[model samples]
Target: MTQDAQKDSSTYWKKSRVELRAAGFDPDRTAKTTAVVTIASAWTNAHRCNNRVRGIADLLVELLAERGGQGLVVGAPAVSDALTQGTPTAGYSLVSRDVVADCFEIGHYAHHGDAMIVISGCDKTGAAALMPLARTNAFGLVLYPGTSSPGKVSFEPWAAKGTNLTIMDYAEGRAAQEAGRISAAELVELERNVMPGSGTCGAMFTANTMSTTAEAIGMMLPRGASHPADYDAASDIHADVRAQARASVEALYRLMEAGIRPRDIMTLRAFENAITTVYAMGGSTNMYLHLLAIARAAEVPLTIERIQEIGERVPLISNLQPHGPYAMTSLHAIGGVPVVMKELLRAGLLHGDVMTVTGRTLAENLAATPTLEEIGKQDIVRPVGQPVAPANNHISVLRGNIAPESCVLKLSGKTLEKGEFRGTARVFDSEADTMKAIRAGEIKPGTVIVVRNVGPVGGPGMPEMVMLTIQLQGRGLGEDVALITDGRFSGVSHGILIGHISPEAARGGPIAAVRDGDTIVIDPGQRTLNVDLSDAEIAKRMAEWRAPDPAGRLRPGSVHDKYVRLVSSAHYGCVV
Candidate 1:
C-alpha cells in the first residue's frame, strides 16, 4: 500500500479504538470493534451520467474517518470499485451488495457491529436506501447528486421578446403541423432557453420536488439540496457534506450514550414538517403518494384524510414553476427552504420542535442560521402572517357522487363558477388525440373537454397533462374551454382545468360512463361532477362501458410499468 493509504489505515484503526473505548467497551473488546459498513448506492442511470455517486461515497468515507470510525463501502460491484479507486487514501474496507436491498440489510446488520452512512441519489435508489435505514433505525445521511449544470444556453432573448405562444398554441398543433415546422433540435433549444439553469430541470417535476421536499423535511442540510452538479462550488459543498456525515455518526453515538433512540425523534412532527414543505413548495402531486409510502415504511399511519387536512391549511408560498414564476435557484437565492420553514413557524403552521437530520431542534437550527431576510430582498421570501395566500392553496380533496373515494384538484382561488356549467362533452381518450383535435379546430366554445384513462392507474404514473391545458389558453376559446380528467394537472395550471378525477376509467369511475355528446356539468360551489342523465341511465351505461386494459396493444407495458405498478398499489394519494 502507498504511504498515504498506510497512514489512513492506521489513523482509522486508532480512531475506531478510541470510539469503542468512549462507548464503554472494555479495552480487550475494542480489538474486536464491529466494522462500520457504508452503503454507497447510486441509481443505475445516475451512475452512467457522471461520477456523482462515487464522489458522494468518497466524501462520506472521509467524514466517517473524521468522526473516528471506519466503514466498508458497499454497492453494485462497478460503483463500489469506482468509489474505491476515487477514495484510495481512505482506509475503509470495500464490499458489494448483490441487490440494492441487500446493501441496506447488510448495512443494517453491520450496525450491530458498526455504524453506517448511505450515499444515494435518483428515485429508486433513494427509496431503497431509506427503507433499511428506517428499519434498522440506523444513523444515516443522504448525499443527493444535486441539480444538473446550466449549459451554455440563454433565456434573455425569450424574456426580451414575447412569442404570444402558450401551451394551448402547441396543443392546437398550430406549431407542430404549421408550414414553419420547428425541428426537434429547435424545440429542445427552446426548452433550454426557458430552463436556463443547473438544477434538475428547474420545473416542479419529480426530481426537483423530491430534492426540495428532502431539504424541507430536514433530510439533507439546508442549501445542501440545491447545488448544481457541475458548479464550481460543488467541491466545497462536498466537503461540507463530509462534515455532515461525521456529525451524523457522532450524533448516533451521542444518542446511544444518552439512551435516546431514533424513534424518539422520528415523530409525527417530521411528517407534519414534510406536509408543510410540500404545500409551500407547490410540490409534485406524486409527493402525496411518496409521502404515504414513506409514512408506511416508517410505520407511521399517514392517511389521505390527514394529508388533506394539512393541505387545506398550508398555503402555497414557493413561487417556482410550474406553479409560480421562479425556479429552484431563485428560491435558494431567496433563502431557500430555511426561509420557508421560518415562515411556517411564524405563521404557526409548523412544529418548531421537529427533529432534523442535523440532530438539532428545527427552531435551534433556524436561530443559528442566517436570517431569511439577510439572504435576499425581504420581498423575495414572503412573510409568514402576510402570506401569498391565506393557507396552502394548491391541493384540495373533493368528494361527490362522481368521485366516491375522493378526488384532488389544484385550487388557486375561490373564483370557480359557482353553479353548474352545462356543456356538451367532447371526449378524448388520449392527450395526443385531444391535442390533435384541438389543433384541427374541432373543439368549440362551451365544450367540456373530457380526457379519460389518465388517472393514477390509467396514466400509470399519472403524468402531468396540464401543460396541454395551459396551451389551450392561447386559443380563442381558452377561457371557455373547461378540461376534466381522471389524471392530474400541474400545480401551475391552476384556474383553467380540473384534474385528479379519481375512480379512474380503468376502475370504471363515473367519468368513463359519460357519452361523447352527453351534457356534463361541474359545480365547484357544490363540489359535484354530474351528467344530465338519471342515475339509472348512468348505471346502465357504466355496466355496458368497457374499461381499457393497459396491457392491451395500445398501451403495452414496458419500463413505464414500474411507475404504473407504483401508482396502482398506491393508496389514494400515496405514490407507492
Candidate 2:
C-alpha cells in the first residue's frame, strides 16, 4: 500500500480493513486510497419489480471498484404492494419503506461510508432509498431501476390507443372479471401479458412518479429516471442506460471530492421543483406522503398544506396511466422527464437554479436535453398552456368538521369537472367489508363510501386500498360512487376518492363516528370535506368511540405495533 493511503489509517481502519479482507476484498488495493461507497438496494426474489435491482447494484459495485473505490453491497427489505394487495400483509407496504431506509442507514453508518448509491424499482423503494442519503446529506445519487416492458401481445383490445399493458391493466381486468364484464379467458390473457419483464410497473404509478420526482428534486442522475430496465442492444438510447449508470458511479467520486452533499441539491427549491413535476405529470397522490417524509428527513420544511398550495399553481400536463392513456416508456420516447421539466421551466413553474446530482443546475441539465419535438412527436406530455387539467388540484387538501386536521381529495380533470359530490355516507370499518359491499352491488350512486378504522393509527401501517378502488372502477361506479378513507390509496387508484384522513379513526377522528345514511359532502372547489351533522353531535358520537384492540389485528410487540406506537398521522408523513 502507498504511504499516502496509510497516512490516515488508524487502528480502527486496520480492523475494518481486516474485515474487508475476510470478505474477499483487497482492502489495501481498493479501500486504502479510495472512498467507501455503499451500494444499497431493496433487492429480493420476492417480486419482479424489485428483483432487478440486485443486478444493477452488482454493476455499480464493479464500476466503483474500477474507479479504485471500495463498494459495499447492502440489501434492504423489499415489499411489493401489488403482490400484497387483498392480503393481510398489505399493511406492511408503507412499513417496508421505513424498514428499508433504516436498513440502509445501518449499513452505511456501520461502514462509515463516504458515499452511497441506492438502486430501487418499486413504489416505496425509491423514497426509501432516498431517506438515508438525505438524512445524512451524503454524497450520493438514486438510480431508478426503470420501468418494465409491456407485454408483447399483438392484440390489445382493452388497451388505449398508443398505450401498452401494465400491471394496472391486469388489476382492472381482474375487477372486470369479478364484475362479469370480461370473460375468464380475457382476464387470463391480461394476467399473462400485463408485466412481461423486469423493472417497475409500466404505468406512472408510485414507482415511476417517485423516480420522476427524484429527477426533478435533483437527487438522480440526469435522464436516469427515464430509461427502461430491460435494455435493447439495437437501440443506442436504450443502451445508454447502462452507460449512465457507469457514469453515475464515476460522478460519485467527483461529488465526494467537491463536497456536494444531498442537502446541497435537495433544497427547499429543489423540493418545490419536485412538487411541480408531480403536479404537471398528474403523478401519484402517494407523492404527497413520500415527499413529506423525504422532506422531513432532509430537514426541509414541507407539509400537506404547502404541497396543496404548490399544486394550486401547477397544472397537470402529462396524460399517463390510471387517469390517462399512456405508459411511462411513452414519455421516455419523448425525451424522458426532462421534456416535462423543460416545459415546466418554460412556463416559469420550476426552480431552474436548483442544484442536481449531475453537478449542474436543473436549468443546465435541461438546456442540453432534447425537447419533445426534437426527439420525436408525442402528446404524452402536453404543453403548460394546454394542460390535461387546468388546475393541479389533484391533491386537494380538505378540512372541515369531518377531517379537522385535513384529508386529501385526489382529483383529475374528469373528476374536477364534476366539481363536487354530495351523498349519503355508507360507513364500513374495514376494507374487507367495503370490498364485500361493493362486490355485493350494495354500493349505490351518490354514495360516499366511508372506510374507517384503517388509517395509519388504526391499520398500524396505513395499507393502500388500490384493489378496492379498481373494483369500483371495473363495476362502473368509479364516478358514480365516492370513497373516503383514513387509509391511503395506491398511485394506480383514481376516481372520486379522498384519502389520508388525518386524526384517524383509532384516535377517535370524526370518521369513526360516521354512521350509515349520514350525509357527506366532498367539495374540491371549497377545499372542504364535511358531514351534514352538527359538530356537537359528531363530538358526542366520538366520545363513545373505542379504539380497536391491538391484539385483534396484529400481534402485540410486533413490527406493526412498534410502527403504530411511533408513527405520526398520515398528513405528517406517517414517519416513525
Runs in model 1 with CA error above 4 Å?
1-35, 45-51, 66-132, 149-199, 232-262, 370-378, 412-424, 439-446, 459-482, 488-499, 519-533, 550-576
Candidate number achieving the greatest TM-score relative to the actual structure? 2
Clashes of 2: 0
lDDT, candidate 2, 492-531, per-residue tens? 8999989999889998788888899999988888889999
Return the TM-score for each candidate structure: 0.73, 0.95
Decoy 2 TM-score against native = 0.95
List the lowest-lDDT window of 10 residues for candidate 2. Answer: 1-10
Per-residue lDDT of candidate 1, residues 409-518 (tens digit): 55553234445456899998777788778767788888988888766566654555654564565454546777878765543354446666777876788888877898
The whole-model lDDT of each prediction reads: 0.55, 0.81
Single out the weakest 10-residue window by summed lDDT for candidate 1.
Answer: 89-98
TM-score attained by model 1 = 0.73
Error of 1 at 3 (Å): 39
